[model samples]
Target: MAVQTYSGSCHCGNVRFEADIDLAEGSGKCNCSICSKTRNWSVSVKPEGFRLLSDEQATTDYQFNTQSVHWPFCRTCGVRAYGHGDIPEVGGKFVSISVACLDDVTPEQKAALAVRYADGGNNNWWNEPSDAEKQYL
Candidate 1:
């Protein structure tokens, strides 16, 4: 798939960034507490594929629980721009960018992309290999 460029920013326009990602692989929605509360529909990409065009000082970090993930939000607008997940097995990092913040992407194009639902809230159930596991694991 061709690499596509996407531009996005915070609601108050204090933070802005661009990313080169594969839209064909599409996006995902995690049923975890934070994600569910924020309604954050996102897509994961390698750390190197994303670029922050503005001042990094304008961003604030929010972390909870195990704190393995870093949630970066705009300080001025309180909008989550992206998040980082550690993946030691792959020797890489997973970055989840908010799809709602992405600009210039047509609604049709967004709808056409595949949406994978992750059962993060019921993470332990993923090991059971049941029908629900097959649906969102």
Candidate 2:
């Protein structure tokens, strides 16, 4: 599938970004604590594939588990607009951009891409859950 550029922002528009993604490739939904709680619908891209247009101070970071991921949320509205993490298999770093925040995509448009559900809750039914993190699109 061809890569396309898309724009997005936080609920209060405090955090904004642009991402180059191939929507046909789909995104991810994990039943992990943070994911399920936040209703995150996200897709991954390399650092270069994403650009944060807002001031870095507009967002706050929250992390758990192995603390490998830096989940960023809008300080004003508490919206988790995006996240950064590492996937050694693909690259040294990656960004998990929220499909829900895509300005041009409707719920249907976002849903059009096949979503792969990870059993994060079950896979992480322990203190250490890194071994269960997903490694896919």
Candidate 3:
């Protein structure tokens, strides 16, 4: 799919954002602790493709392990709307938009998109894990 702008928000609607994403580029799931726990399904986009449509102070950030990624969520609803980090593999600064939080994307559209799995639990960002490992991720 071509790049398109998507609007999204947290459960309480206190945190809202917009991002331009191309689902054909694929979304990702990671076995990293936070991702696994949150069941984060996301797509990456350059910082320019993302916009915070609400007050930045309405969100809170959480960082762990390497503390490289900043996961921001709505303070009122505790829904992780998106995350930001510097990943050389993805150019430089990038935003990881939560696919599930997208308000305009239908379930059918999300199901049809390609998904990639990462073995972030083991710190292997560049390698795809075994099929068996992917099952649980």
Candidate 4:
């Protein structure tokens, strides 16, 4: 996959960023509670390729449950821009970008991307496949 430049920002435009990422594929959508509620569709990216163009203070963090991840949103408009996953040994890591936050990318561009379904709410996501699971998984 070739590397391509993509730009995105939070709702109020306080947090803007540009990423040189391999957009050859779409990312997975999790059926977890938080994801379902927000309808968070995303794509994967290497931690290094993703950059923070604005000051970190421009966003506020929202965490819950085990508190393993940080969902950073624009403090002004309350739009979730990105997130950090807590992996053991690696600590917190940025693994994906919210598709809704990205710009100039169309649904067709996203359709060509790969999709993975995460069982975040249920730890045993690997074991079960519900009827609706066929679409994204």
TM-score of each: 0.85, 0.83, 0.93, 0.82
Best by TM-score: 3
Model 1 regions lying over 4 Å from their true place = 89-91, 124-137
Candidates' lDDT values, in order?
Answer: 0.81, 0.82, 0.89, 0.76
lDDT digits (tens) for residues 1-137 of candidate 2: 68989999999999999999988888887778888787777898889999999999998888888898999889999888899998575468999988889898777777588877766677643232343454421
Which residue ranges in model 4 land beyond 4 Å of their true spot? Answer: 89-92, 127-129, 133-137
Rank by TM-score, highest first: 3, 1, 2, 4
Q: What's the lDDT of the predicted structure labeled candidate 3? A: 0.89
- Clash count for each candidate, listed in order shown: 0, 0, 0, 4
- Candidate 1 least-lDDT 10 residues: 125-134
The alpha-carbon lDDT assigned to residue 30 of candidate 4 equals 75
- After the best TM-score superposition of candidate 4, give how far the Cα of residue 9 lies from its true spot, in angstroms: 0.7
Q: Which ten residues in a row have the lowest lDDT in candidate 4?
A: 125-134
lDDT (tens digit, per residue) of candidate 1 on 1-137: 67889998989888898988898988877667788688778888888888989898899988999998899899998999788878575356888899889897789878887877766777741333345533543
Whole-model lDDT, candidate 1?
0.81
Model 3 clash tally, residue pairs: 0
Query: Positional deviation of 99 in candidate 3, in angstroms?
Result: 0.6
